[model samples]
Each structure stands twice: as structure tokens, then as C-alpha cells.
Target: MAYELYYWDGIQGRGEFVRLALEEAGAEYIDITRESGRGRGTGAMLAIMQSDGEALPPFAPPFLKDGDLIISHVANILLYLGPKLGLVPDDEALRYVVNGLQLTITDFVAEVHDTHHPIATSLYYEDQKEEAKARSAAFIKERIPKFLGYFEKVLNQNPEGSDYIVGNALTYVDLSLFQIVEGLVYAFPKAMSNYRGSYPLLAALRDRVERRPNITHYLRSDRRLAFNTEGIFRHYPELDIGVS
Candidate 1:
């Protein structure tokens, strides 16, 4: 059966990572929220925040429904799907390394999210705009370089060369990295522009992922949504230094 993906319908957010892997692997799946009349939209997503379902239901969206299993957490979902989707290696050690990298990406993602919502996720960006401004400044100056620097180090240290993160093959980790760079660039254009040149392997990897046949098609198709403030990576000019 085709996997059923449940996420807020609009803006890629965390869902796009899963979507990208699925698209790249040519896997069959249904984006539930975008199925015309079925599934929830932003309203439903907000309702879920207060509903009892929040406790037991998939914690945060980009959840996957396959058969009887309902899985949440983007990294966990990727871990489960990686091997199933042929996006991970077979060796146990390699798998562990890939997962480790994926978890690091998760940390990086959380940091990125915190840049815009440093004070509180419950508070509006406007209410926390001052904190965000400070946090974003640190992120652009310190955090971005640190995270990107770590990834660059990984690439340089990889025994398999810089073409891929794990071994010589492409894994879900690589895909997630591509998404990170894309999201960062989208959310912090000025910061990214200034520092992206330092990570050539990452830049090349991002370009290659986008050029994948399925990803290319998806980018041109209606399934892809533009980034907006409603999502995790919001672009508030006041918070961003270079976006005028």
C-alpha cells in the first residue's frame, strides 16, 4: 500500500524532507492534507495542538501512516523509511553512522527553528521579535558557521570522499543535508550567501539533489509550496539583516 503522509497542508516545513526522500526514491505515497477534501489544513493542525491527540498522536506532523503503524518525528520517520526506501546502507555500522548524522541534522534543524522562535514557540514572532533579533544575530554569526563547519569537517573526513555523507553512496542523511542548506538559504539568505562558499561539497550536494529527476519534476509541479511565515522558517525582514 502507498504510504500516507499527514502534515499541515501548506509550506514544506519538516514535511518536505520526507517528501524529498520519497520523491527521490520514486516511492508511492499520498500527502493526506493536500487530498482536496480530506485530511486537515492549518485549522486542523492548530486544533490538534490543543486536542488530547497531541499527547499520544504523532508528536508534531510530517507523520507517516503505513498499514497499522503511525509514525511521527521527522528523523524517526526517516530512520524507519531509509532502509525500506533504499536510502540507507545495509551494514549495521554504516546504518548507525547514517542515523547519527541524521540526528545531528535534527539538532541543526532545531537550532534553525530556534533562531526564529528563541524565546518561546507559544509566543508570536512579533511578541518575541527582540529575542529573535538577538538570537538570529548569533545564529548568523556563530551558529551557522559552527553547524556548517561541522558538516564540512564530516565531508572532509569521510573515507569515501565528499560526494556523499556516508560511504560512497547517497543516503537519507545526504537528502536531509540538502534540505538543510535549502531551508537555511531560504530563511537566511544574507547569512547563507556570505558563508555558503565555504562548504563546496554541501553546495554541490544540494545542487545534485535538486537536479534529481523526481525532485526536478516536483519543484515544477503544484505539490511544492513556497516558504512562508506560517511555517517553521519564517522570513521577517526585521529579524533578518539582509532581506530588505
Candidate 2:
């Protein structure tokens, strides 16, 4: 059976990470929120979220419905899908290691979101512009390098001495990192002007992930959405510290 993914209709948001994994593995799935039917749109996602069943309800979007299980959270959803889609290592220890990498990316994504919505998610970006500028300055100057550099260290220290994050092969973590790099580049182009020189391994991995057969097709197809101000990564020049 095909997987049913629940997420917002517009921005890529956290949902794009899961979408990347499923696409790379060529898994059959339905992006239910984007579908154009009565039972297959955002209402479908709301119904699931508002259900009063005994099962635990997800607090947000980017949840997956597979068989009888409803998995939510980007990392949690990927944790379950990785094994099924052959995007993780067979060794149990290494799988957990990759999971750690994915969780770190989750933290990095949260920080990126805070760059634009520093004060509060409920408030408009305009309302928080001054605070966002201050927060983003610190984020671009510190957090970006800290997070991206950590991933660089991971790629450089891979025991197998491969380009991939975990083993010599691609894992879901690699896909997540690729998505993060893409988002950072889009949201902070001025700040990322030297990304290749600063984080060569991570940069190379992003390029390689882009060229993967399935990913290449997906990027060229309409299924892929462009990064926008509405998403976690928003481009606001004044917020960035620029290339230092």
C-alpha cells in the first residue's frame, strides 16, 4: 500500500525532508495535502489531526500514515521509513548513529526557523523584524557555522571513509542534510557565499544528492516546490550578516 503524507499545501516546510526520502527510494506515496479531491486535501490532514480515536494524535503536520500506524514529526517519520525504504544501514548500531545525525539536523532546522520568527511564531515577521535581525545576526555568525561545521566533521570522520554521512552508501540522514543545505543556501545566500570553501564535504554531498537519479527527476518536475518566505527558511536580506 502507498503511504499517505499529511502536511501543509503551500511551503515545503518539514514535509520536504520526508518527501525526499520517499522519492529517492522510489516509494509509492500520496501527498494527501496537495491532492485536489474532497477527501484528499488539507481537510484530510485536519480530519486526522482532529480525530478522537484512541491512538495518539500528532500535534502538527508532516505526519505519515502507513498501514495502521500514524507516525508524526519529521525525524520520527523518517526513523520508521528509513528501514522500510532501504535508506538506512542494516546494522542496528549504525542505524541509531544515522538517527542521531537526523535529530541534529532537526535542531539545526529549528534554529533556522527562529532566524525569521525569533520573537514568536504567532506574530508576523514584520512585527518581529528588528528582533529577527538581531537573532539572525547571531544565527548566521554562530549557529550556521556550528551546525554546518559539525556535519562537515561527520562526513570527514565517517569510519568507512566515504562521502556519505553514515557508511559508504546514502542514508536518510544524507537526504536530510541535503535538504538543510538547500534551505540554508536559499534563505541566506549572502551568508552562504563561501559555503563551498567553508564546508566542502557538506557542499559536495548536497551536489551529489541533487544528482541522484530520482532527486534529479523530482527537482526538474513540478512536484518540487521552491523555497518561499512562508516556509521555515525565509530570505530577508537585512536579517543576514552577509558573507564574513
* Tens digit of per-residue lDDT, candidate 2, span 1-244: 9999999988999999999999999999999988978699998889889999737888999999998889999999999998999999999999999888889989898999998898889999999999998899899898998999899998999898748999888999999989998998888898998999999999999999999999999999899999999998899888766765
lDDT string, candidate 1, 31-125, tens digits:
87776555445555445545775456655787887896878888889989998899998787898889888888888888888988998888987
lDDT of 2 at 61: 90
Sliding window of 10 residues with minimal summed lDDT for model 1: 37-46
Estimate candidate 1's alpha-carbon lDDT, on a 0 to 1 scale: 0.81
Which 10-residue window in model 2 sums to the lowest lDDT? 235-244
Off by over 4 Å in 2: none
Candidate number achieving the greatest TM-score relative to the actual structure: 2
Cα TM-score of candidate 1: 0.90
Error of 2 at 193 (Å): 0.3
